[model samples]
Target: MTWKRLVAIAIVIAVGFVGTILAGGLLPSGLASAQQEHREHGAPSSAPAAGAPTIAAVAVDFKFTPPEIRIKAGQTVNLVLTNRGAILHDLIIPGLKFHAAAEPGKKGTASLTAAKPGTYEFYCSVPGHREAGMKGRLIVTR
Candidate 1:
C-alpha cells in the first residue's frame, strides 16, 4: 500500500478508537462505573432500608417534581431520585454535602439525616442544570 493510504488508514483507526473511549466503551459497564464513582466520591451508595421514610423525586426536562421536601430534624430520609428525562440527572444538597446521580430512565437513592431546623437548598449539580430550574427546597423542622 502507498504511504499516504497507510497514513490515512491509521488516522481513521485512531479516530475511531478515541470515539469509542469518549462514548464510555473503555469503562467497565458505564452505569456501574458511574455508580461506583459516585460512592467513591462520598455519595450514598444504597437506598434507604425498606419501609424507611422515603421521598421520591422525579427529574424530567430540567425540573424536580414536588420541588419542596419537608422533614423533621434528625430524621433519616431516603431520597429516591428518578431521571425521567432523556438525560442524566442528580440531586445534590449542598448544605448537607450529599449527592446522587441517575441515568435516563433509571433511579438512584441516597440517604440523608436532617440536622438543624432550617431551610436548605437542593439542586442538580450538573452544569447549567440548577440555573435551568433543577432545584428545590428542603425544610427541616425542630
Candidate 2:
C-alpha cells in the first residue's frame, strides 16, 4: 500500500482506539454514580441475617403462574423459578440487576434482597416474552 493510504488507515485506527478508551472510562464513573444513587434512594432497609424467605413460581406457555409476589423490605428472598413450558424462560428484575434462566423442564434460583418498600416489575428478558405477558409484580412491604 501507498504510504499516504497506510498513514490514513493508522490514523483511523488510532482515533477509534482512543474513542473506545474514552468511552470505557466514562462507563465506570457512570456506574459508580448509579450505585450511589441506588444506595441513597433505593437501598435495602436491612440485610437478611438468617434464612431467607422462599418464593416459588412456574413458567408456563407465555405466562408466569401466580403473577405477583409479596415480601417485606430488608428481607432476602430465594426465588425458585421453574420452567415447565416447551420453551426457555428466565426471570429478570431490572431494578435489582437480578436474572436467572431455566430451560424447558428445568429450574433456576436467584437470591435477592428486597429494597425499599415498593412495587417492582419482574419479567422474562427473552424477546417478546414481556409483551406476551410473561411478567409479574413484586411488592415489597414495610
Candidate 3:
C-alpha cells in the first residue's frame, strides 16, 4: 500500500535523524567543535594556525607510518592521517589531548600545539590496535 510505504519511510528518516542527534550529543565538546568546521576544500582540512607545520601520516593494518613525529614547543602541528588499512584507525595523543581518526580508505585531520618540550606518546585509540603496535611518540623540542 502506498500509505504503508510512506509511513515506513517516515519512520526510517526519523530514526536516522534521532541517531545523528544522539551521536552528536555524546561526543566531547572539543571533538564536536572541531568537526563542525568541515569544508569541501577538495579535502577536509583542520586549518591549523598560522605558521603551523602540516605532516602527512599513514595508518596501515597495525602500524603507523614513520612511527614518530617531531615538533617544536610553542609551534602548532597539523596532521593528516590516511587510513590504508582494512579497518578503522585513529590517532590520539593522550598528553596533548589531540585526536584524529580515519575509517578504512578515508582520511582525517587534527591539529596540536605543544607548549611544553617533552616526549608524548601517541597511538591509535581503537580497542586492541595499540597493543598490536599502533603506538608512536611525539617529540616536542624547545
Q: Give the best candidate by lDDT.
A: 1
TM value for model 1: 0.67
Q: After superposition, how far is residue 98 of candidate 2 from its true place, in Å?
A: 1.4
Q: Evaluate residue 128 in candidate 2 and report its C-alpha lDDT on the 0 to 100 scale.
A: 64
In the range 1-142, model 1's lDDT, one tens digit per residue, is 9999999999999999899988876565755655654445455545566667888999998899989989999888788999998988888887887787888999998888877999999888665677789899999998
Model 2 lDDT tens row, 9-121: 99999999999999999988866764553344332223323577778989988888889988899888888889998987887777877676778999877787767999999
Candidate 2 residues lying further than 4 Å off, grouped into runs, are 1-50
Estimated TM-score per prediction?
Answer: 0.67, 0.63, 0.65
Q: In model 2, which range of ten residues has the least summed lDDT?
A: 40-49
Instruction: Say which prediction, candidate 1 or candidate 3, comes out ahead on TM-score.
Output: 1
Error of model 3, residue 24, in angstroms = 33
Ranking by lDDT: 1, 3, 2
- Deviation in Å, model 3, residue 19 alpha carbon: 39
RMSD of each: 7.6, 9.6, 10.8
Worst lDDT 10-window in candidate 1: 37-46
